[model samples]
Target: MSEPEEDLQEEQRDSTKKKKKKEKRSGKKKKQKEEREQEEAQQQVDEEEEERSECVVLRGIFKLGKKSHDVLLTRTRLTWIPITPETPTGEPCVLQPGVVLTAGRVRGEGEAAASGRPAVGGAVLGVALFCCRRRGRRLEEDTLHLHNASAEHTQTWYNTLKELLAGFSSRPRYLKVFINPSSHKKEAVHIYREHVAPLFKMADIRIDITVTERKGHALSVMKECKLDEYDGVVCVGGDGSVAELCHALVLRAQLDADSPEKPVKPVLPLGIIPAGSTDVVSCSVHGVRDPVTATLHIVLGHLQQVDMCSFLSQGQLVRFGFSAMFGFGGRSLARAEKKRWMPSSRRREYALVKTLARLRPEDCQLSFQPAKTSTGNLFEHRDEDQDVKQDPESEGEESWTTNQGLYLSISIMSIPCLSPHAPRGLAPNTSLANGSAALIAVGNTSRSEFIKHLKRYSSSSGQFSFSFVETHAVSAVRIRPSSLINWSEEESEEEGDSKTTPIIQSEGAAFPWNIDGELVEIANEVLVRVHPRLITLYGEEVDEAESTVSCSCI
Candidate 1:
């Protein structure tokens, strides 16, 4: 072979080898890129799953020697994550296992302010007969001070196996409960006995129940009961029961006092366990009136305090969880009561029939004092004393002043919503603990006008100004007909002329009045004052913002 042929062949082999090496490098790079992308995708999926499961519920009891503590909790709402083992100041030892829990709030200073000690949430973690501290440890010695973190050297054990519960959720500090059967409804007692008792077994509470025997018993009961005993009271019957309950609860505070010398406290709380013909409160508070879910809230120990108002007639007080109203429409309450003897299913139609027949302009006297310039203005004591030296005779006319008008009905409430059926409720500026009342009256004539007012009251669609409302706080009220007031001539005649209509005399006679949901014949005048923390309510201490916004207050 020639020298030229050998050189050409060698060059051809070198070029082919270079091409093969380049192809191998490209394939390897492609494979690496694909593997990198796969890993990134898997990592992204894992990250998403972790975020969804970021919530951790740790429940267990800490045992120091022979003593054990119970810890019941739902979730911790915090602004920052905590990493230290130190016990937060003012916060109780919630790390202990087997402790019963309820959703609660904790206030402390700085980090300590948010600690969960002095839990106001009305959650009962079973009965704690005693809480003894360790022999040498000085922790929990002062409830007002911040608790120190348990020393690592101190001996302690946690029991997490049996006490660790899963599937916990967040909840409120107050709840609404209804007792429907109350003897008048066949299933009210059964429902309470079978279901309500179990839920109560899991919470802390002071309950007020109204049992109706005759038809309007619930209404009369609601008109007379004290609202301070509960965070929320519920009705277990049908629509009429709810309506009557709401009607009585919606009456504005006529006087500050439940009793003359002692001012009344906040109106009781409201809730419903719908066993009635119609469950408006239930449907409104929650979209559905599921008994099991309602029972679950009690079991889970959720609580919230709501606002209410009081109405005064003569000198007696009537409290409203919703509104204080009058007019011929209030007769619907009496009619609904009379129809209770019929089947629950038929009560609605019968009530409508009675309402249509009895619809009329109920002539009443309405006197109102406009809402003060500010809430501070409600309390005369809180104002500047410009008249401390004024003549006593000049004060007489001001002290005995009164306003009067004619009306088909009058209603004032604490909440903006009533019965879940009516929208516009108590004055928006009112609060459960603010120590004031809303005064509303309807003077419209004819059934249509009365209904229009009723619709406006119930729909809550109005954007009313201060001019449309009369809000005030007073110690007494006087209600009487501006014109000729008539008692049922038929009912009065049966007792003969000697009865003299049992007139609500300005001097000596007792007038029938509603307190909370209970009814009673009270003395002609109701003297009211603010009740200072009369009953302990287990829930968040109402904040200024919430008190100013919605009517749900504690």
Candidate 2:
């Protein structure tokens, strides 16, 4: 064959390969185009569905700042889109219903109305939306102004917003307020007037205020007051005030049912305004200890049903509380109570220093009933014998676990007690309404090691990772403290030292217990049982909290 014939055959093969490669590339581009079109179509359908779910109550043209935009009001949100020449409907600025506090007409405004822009066609008519803007853990009030040229248009928007806000049934119309005048810094009244009253007035909520004169004044009011007229009860004080109100409300329900054994749930919800030093309950529920945030939670009608613990001594009702601490906690509080003349802050510091200087463990016996594997409603009151007979399959299993020894501190909490000192809470494993409580037992250890364990609560995690600490989820607990005189004498005799006296030496003396920040004295064993969803509070469950404050006493 000739060289020219071989070159012609090679050229023919190269042309055929190039044609097949070009066809494959074209087919790939066509398939990519088809996939892109399908994705776009699905996104459009999804947007349409979301719009349909949120029915638009009103839509019109309104000016935000200096720009003319299309505003839309829905049942759950208010949104506005910038209308520019390039993009007629630009990105929307959405305002959820939870953030909006109220709306009203704004007349004769300067910067608040269109950034000092004069009305183009007629007199300036504007509507202002009052909203609570959340920045991290704090909530600040802000205003969004929308102006239009027509007066009737602005009036229509204002009226519609007012009617929509009124339709929220969860929000309270009337509240029975009890203000304790002797809270931290004696500023409970001032905090309410400065930060809380104006918001309630703006929301048109009628409040019947009563300034408490004594420690149990709120309880007295709760006993005789008409619960039907008020939508809810508001406590403007510390955790003690909150605990007192809770006990009063629960007792009232029991009396109304004419059965102390079978107490019913409270008919009205309770709202707490933080005015105390350590606002543990307020911080746990609202995730912050700010008064405005608490009031906003009440105004927004956020509901959280919390578990409650009932303390009984000698088979008699003592009180209903959310959390309790014995040993060091009780002794410190008792010492603080003795120095009532001192300032609250100074009193707490003095008590803490004194207690730490004389840190000692108490001899106590603890018995707790572990929670069942499958969670059930704990609200229904049942006898222990009845529960045991009903579950015959678990006859061999032990229901209660007992532990007796010396302990520096023991804490039982139904809700995670979140505060500034403890960001993750003293009981980080427990939840708000989980039908169980967290039993934390700290065994005897050196003072330095114990302080290290206490200081770990403020960190992010690992607060209960110490060798002397133990945690369990329980439904009921019995705490019995040994006689102080008897235990001390026996120890001194064993050591052959007659000069050693008991830390708290008294005959027939009562044991001090810190329950929800209140000091209670009991001479015998106390049984604490958890009741799930016993009372509804005006706040949402908090998963995490941010703390900017720390304790320096350690």
Candidate 3:
């Protein structure tokens, strides 16, 4: 190597170096392109996974938009369903759980691929989101919202459906429904077959309907019903029927006093459906007289406890429930059996008017334990001051005058409202389970005084006003026709009503008693006590609507 040879060699070496560097840079660029493509493919796979995660199975209903449709709850039968969402819309859509659809109509897979989302799927999902757009997104377990719908509407639908679903989560409840066709208005059979049966079917309530044939039919049913076989006994009749049924239940032991030993019994829950002309029990308990309304209350499953009372006559059961009377009214009630053929409207107009017009004082000895002795017992208050003021001045204030004849109306009741006609019913302070019975005894007086006494019974003033009267709460009572006495006789002796041979009062005597509304001619004179938590009732307590009165003077 000469100088010229060295320059040419150096140039060749430079050229070779430049060629190697270019080859190295090209290899590195190719490697980077391959890595970027691989990264894009991996991202595409993850996006597909996220889309798949959105599909969910959701069961729901949607109201038809002015469209009447037949829904097949069972694949075989078509039910004409209401278009409104409130009426179990019956439009059930089973969506993939946790799938959130967008606010656009469902089209083809092309739009889904183009947008890289779930715009369409199976036939079911397609029908559900037909008018709206949908995509695969996580569906929340707590709430499933339909796209493009009103938010408030969606929430309302969800809550109702949730409750409906919750109701079905449990097994069906069997209920024994008792209907008295002879009760007030007498629509028991119709109510049971139409209103009550359908709802019970919807709610899966097993039912056994009994049509009462006579006045005491309901009482006999209550006495013989296998209470443990059912969750509750529902009465679809008037208050009188319910009273009869309840009375019979409460007096089970008393009715069987002559038997060996009282048999152990299971307590049954009582349900009421207002179907009678005077649906006092329904009005008092549920505050509504509609059978459907009452059935809804039963479905809600609320229970309450109410007190019961019994009336006894010399070793025989007469009547029970709230009211027990000894007066012209009692005689009238006994005669009401003859007027059963009269229509409810006629009976209502006639029963009260006739009883009032034909009223006559019947001499009787009415007595009960003082209110002070047994707090819950039916007692009487002798207004000495009022008695003295009303006494004739010529009588010279006879303190313990041997005998006097008079007409009287005795009423013993727990709740104030005796019938639906009297909504003000007993005072608001009254309690159905308070173990107290109010007694209103009206004694004989002048015709003007008798009318005034009747007015007092219905007066807004809760206190009784009378000359020879007593008003108090008691647990037990006794009544017998007074012995006939001659005013001409100088001396008076206790003379029994030998003509009728009235049963005499004595310890451990079985008396005819009436419990609830059914009159048992032989409810043996037996002990009657409150059984706490025995009667499981539904809706408002009887005492919740009592009238307020001032007892400060007591």
Tell me how candidate 2 scores on lDDT. Answer: 0.77
Candidate 2 residues 1-554, lDDT tens each? 89999999999999999998999999999999999999999999998877874778889998878878788877656777777555347645553221232322111120011111223465657876666666666655556778887878887888787777777677789999999988988899999999999888766789999999998899988889989999999999999999999999999988888878965789899999999888889988889989988887777677889999999998899999999998889888988988989988788889888776667777677777776642432222222211122222223654666666667888899999998888888887888899889888777777788888877777547767777777778888888776632222122333322212224445666777899999898888888988998998988778766687655346
| Structure candidate 2, residue pairs in collision | none
Off by over 4 Å in 3: 1-172, 215-225, 248-266, 316-320, 370-407, 426-429, 456-459, 462-469, 483-534, 542-554
lDDT of each: 0.39, 0.77, 0.48
Candidate maximizing lDDT: 2
Which lDDT tens digits does candidate 1 get at residues 1-554? 99999999999999999999999898999899999999999999998766544444443343323344333222322121222244557554434232212223222211111112221244322211111111211111111121123432111111121122112223222334445554335677787667665444333333445566665666565556554444455566654565555544543222324444333443553345656533433443433434444444333333444433334444344433334344433444445445667774476557555554444443333333333323432223211211122223222333432434333444454333323333323344454444345544434345444444444534444423222223354322334543333323123324323211222224443333323323334433333222312221222221111111233211
* TM-score per candidate: 0.45, 0.78, 0.54
User: Per-residue lDDT tens digits of candidate 3, residues 113-163?
Assistant: 010111144322211211111122101111111332344544443343334
Please rank every candidate by TM-score, starting with the best.
2, 3, 1
Model 3 local distance difference test score = 0.48
Model 1: which ten-residue window has the lowest total lDDT?
A: 134-143
Cα distance off (Å), candidate 1, residue 154: 22
